[model samples]
Target: MVVMKKMMIGFLLVLMALLSGCQMSEVYDTSVNLCIIVANRKNQPDFSDSETLNTSLKNVIDSYGKVQIIVPDGAPYIQGTYSIEEPAKRMSSRKAADWRDIQISSMYNILTTTRAQTPEVDLLSAISLAGRWLDDREGEKQLLIVDNGLSTVGLLDFTKNLIRVDANTIVEYLEEKEAIPSLSGIDVTWVGLGDTADSQQSLTPVNRKNLECIWNSICIAGGADSVTFRGDAPSTGNNSESLPEVTPIDIIAEEPMEVPAKQSRTWWLGEEKCQFLPDSAEFVDIDATKSLLQPIVEAVANEDLILGFCGTTARAPGATEQGCQELSLQRALAVEKLMLEMGMDMRRIGVTLGRGYNHPYYINDRNEDGTLNEQIASANRSVIIFSLDSEVAEKLLKE
Candidate 1:
């Protein structure tokens, strides 16, 4: 009798363990709101291909699991592919002085919808939809598979356009429609658009086939998800062009001349370390520093004079002038050492100290003290500029 009782108890415990395991698995296998945007039109000659693609998607989705077809029907979590035209538009100003090849056509019609859905429809919607699968601890990330390439204009230009949209148009639309912003509070896991995948065609629309392949794979292999997508540029032709012998311009420094014309002093990191740096508290990573130092090293080899500016900040709430100076010095020395390692002639390169508390160029408070922070740290920060006389500096500054 005692043996029977022990066995019963053990069986109950085993059942409970199985139930708990099932619960844990259910938590990880989340219901994803997949949104796939394809560029196509039903009335066009390409309609046949669209039908085939749709059927393929249906088969794939059915084979995987329950995927709700996201149409206009009030589903918050949408997974539908739509079409857009070729030759993407330039939302911002003209690129070249001539304005010959700049594309100004809006592929997706923005007039039918009340607000600008391109930001949401193209990229933000997918990101937000994917981000909704947060666990109990509030950690849900999504991968953005943008079918279209990002606008290839400069970063500042993109930021400026975003600001303009926010201030003038998008904000008003949000307020009038009483719609909570779709993309206000989501983190991007990986932003894979159609631009980066192509070797020659870095700015092309992502094809429907490849996008479907990636999405199907993701659904099949479920887990803690990270965003990863490759940009696919448009394929122009199969034939490879022969390379032409050309002179490479030295952008990092200026060559010494017997008679100096008006010189302009500007600073740039070598191709690799062009990313933004938030604060000096973070130690400069060796690889990041090295990336910025490559151009300087190359320019110095051509016997060009280079200058590096070192400056500190007292902008952070607890920061002091002394501390800022020390940090600035470290940054300067970091760049200096990198140039030395790259076989640069240290004699041709000069390092100057410009540590200060006042920033005249910026209008923001880094400390979040709720004060109008109008300090320009860019002027005081370490930079490499060409050597020039006071008259030339003033002229360049005005220009």
Candidate 2:
């Protein structure tokens, strides 16, 4: 009786596989489904990493598994059905190293694919398409998203007002629109959330925190069982210009463009204003700094408000924390002294504070090989003059 019963159970299982048009091996084998999406654009780091995530991304990027290289423009979809190759099994000693070589080649291809760029980033749609990419695959699903978390062409646009908005509110809006991706049961890892490169402006700590909150909330609400965030600063290989340009997000928080009735306005002495020599507070060109601030001094001469000088210093080689701070303070004071020499009232100048490395206006000032580029460093270490708005210039020009 026991033999008969075993036979009957085996027959039923075979029948089930046959009805599903699957072989017995196919019915039970579950392999991995991994999708890596890189949404970086011009001014954001092209996806470069340590590549230490999982055995050289094995079982993730395997031999003969074709990974699509996509820079999201809009309406992202799986190009067509694809077959994921099975992970390698043992090879004969004659061909022993051949199997290893194939996977290594595949890993290189995967990494290189992400370096491509597009004009627009429809990140939300890409996330949705990734879900579809993983659906028919064999095993436990995993999603690795490498981006700066600033999407340009979707509802989560940073160009408008999403950066300053609350995270939960953004998630709720996504929920209402039914725009959230189906990330249930998938493990998601995000890298380089707030890191910017090239022409993209650097984010303040407050902006970085808000970007983290918004992305985390969205991933969780999509029912992802596990979500991970990584701060792996990307290499400085900026290949974004060759492709169509992506719109940059405004890193500076919103301020009144037109002069307000009662507000102290700030002005950035743009990229080429007064860059300095390494570790020196004195402007590289004292005459240039003088030329830049001359108009401002004359306009605010009659104003009753106090002009505040805020300066920041760079982390040059062998520079200590105290040294960085002191250098930044001196930089600010140097600007103030120059203004005074130009007939500015000392009484109008307010307390000068050196922000030091606390706030970097431009970030990722390193070479592709991860060494500090002093030229980039010199450019970021500078000062901003603020007391009255550019409206002061408008008023003076009209008078």
Candidate 3:
């Protein structure tokens, strides 16, 4: 009897040890707040890939602790719980399966309803909204953006080649518009970029690469932890394949334009009075402006020179400081896009800084009678292009 009792005690001790080891090997579930932004529009072909998108959505919803679906330009948008509740006990297989089914049904309904309601694709607004939604949330945060990465409205207008503009330029624009969101600790995944089949223009390899770089830069600048680009069909599993690597851009040197060997030169591209329409960034004469920029473009193409554009705006009556700054940045970007079209290297161009009512060409715009002078204010609304030699360019770049 004593031997039998000893054996039973030994057996119980071994069983407890094995159970503790099994418990240690088990991974604790860490909650994640996931936000998914879907861009629904006719112009974006990626939206048509419903099967892949739905599968990816289902997989993510099933895996994450909490999920939110947001469509900035559509109805029934921004639906999902902000916080996830932890249960006292682990969910059973049946309960988990039911929960997933309910979530999938809810996601499908919300997405379909939103798509039917709105066809506009406002990617910037949707992303900003997602960032705002994720702010202050606990646990791991992830943002999945399913779109062609095109913004037709708001500060970023892809139709205008805004993506070609430098990242710093876009950051400044966002700051001025108060559209910058706190996205620290967020892992951002951008899927379905440049899949614009129904659009008037088709995307080339170079165009696609530029678009990806722009978004990557934008997300990083906005304090995102990381940015990944997954093409039209992202894999739903852990070993999912990544998008094809973007090739380096080849810069072809063009014939140099005749200009004096100067350290720096500033060219003002504007009308006779340097006048622009009230709160407008559209150039009056694109052809003439390009003609004037030909020399600078040639210089940048042929030499290792850097181009810097400064946009200055005059404060109009009742114009907010932020509004003026945003207008100036847009005007600068307009010129930057022209330069890009003219075959200048995107990396060679510096950030377009917006100086709103700060650096005025016509400082004496105030009339003797203390009335605001429209002519001088108009002069202030000019895009000044500065061409710098190698030394000057390096110095300014360091600064």
Candidate 4:
């Protein structure tokens, strides 16, 4: 009787262990909630890419507890969700197969409907809305973004000056505008970025790098746990095959220029004959100034170059000496601010000075009455970028 009791106890223990193992396995099979946001802004959508993404998505959703497709162009962000059944008795093989088929069919329908119904894509709004939808949702969350990642409309327009802005500056702007979304605990995957035909114009190598950097920073700033990019490589097209492979401009200082100790070399901005507006430091032609500054910016970034801004102004009618000096200082400070905003390091910029009506470039071109020459007075009312390193002349020549 004692042996029989021991045998029974051992049998019960084994059975309990088996049941516990089964429960652990079931827990491991828990489902996830997947959110997909598609950008449908291209003139011609790539159906092949769409199909590839859909297949991958279906594979992911097969094990998901729930799935939501967020199509931004629609009035309501959620386009559809996979049908989920209530927890009950274990399903038979036949029933499980039927459920999988139904879910896949539903996913296909959702994709088709989204592609057909979406008219224009507003990327920022879509992300904001999707983030709101996912907030406080249950289950493991995943966000899959399908778009070129370009914001064509609203405050974050890439077509405007936004692209030229630095990544940190862009993030600050978005935050100030209350445009960033809360994406904490979400894993984001960006697809189809820089892949569409329409993106050819805007998706150069540098631009693509900038876009990825900006998006990555934005996602991190918005509290995303992880961000991944799975997009087509940026292509310059077959026409690029016929084009010549241009060499990179060498901006290094080949031979340092000779200069006296404590003296500087000056690089002027405007025509020798033109003058800046009186009491104003703003760039008269921003585009032209940008073009000229590009090389200087690059040289400074690539080499050991230190830059200083000296603002000088011609004596304006009734403008006191102090006022002129103050205006000149403001102009020099303005140039420094512009360069800093354009992504230059602040450490490289030094010594902003204002010299009012002093050391004119064309002193001999004065009017017959010994007053400043109007034709060449504009030259004096300018910002002079100088470098203490005499080597800058050689570096500028290489550029």
List all candidate RMSDs to the true structure.
27.6, 23.6, 24.3, 17.9
Model 1: runs farther than 4 Å from truth?
1-265, 268-283, 359-399
Return the candidate ranking by TM-score, descending.
Answer: 2, 4, 3, 1
User: For residues 7-67, what per-residue lDDT tens digits would candidate 4 score against the true structure?
Assistant: 9999999877655433111232555667788523343234334544655455554545566
**Candidate 2 residue runs with Cα over 4 Å from true position:** 1-29, 52-56, 61-70, 74-89, 92-98, 114-118, 253-399
Per-prediction TM-score, please? 0.27, 0.51, 0.47, 0.48
Which has the higher lDDT value, candidate number 2 or candidate number 3?
2
Clashes of each: 20, 1, 0, 3
| Local distance difference test values of all predictions, in order | 0.35, 0.67, 0.64, 0.63
Top model by TM-score, which number?
2
- Residue lDDT tens for model 2, 9-92: 999998775555421122223555667676435667755553433332554444334343334554343433334464345334
Q: How many Å off is the CA of 389 in candidate 4?
A: 28
Question: Which residue window of length 10 is worst by lDDT in model 4?
Answer: 242-251
lDDT of 1 by residue, 1-399 (tens): 999999999999987765543310112342332333232211101111233323333322322222222211112235333221221432222232112122111112321121211221223333234434322112222233333322212221121223222322433443465422233222222223322321323221223333333333333233333334443333332221222111111112224457755344445332124322555523347676666667656655654455544443435556676776676555556566666777877675554553434333322445355442434434334433444333323333331
lDDT of 1 at 260: 55
TM-score of 3: 0.47
lDDT at 191, model 3: 69
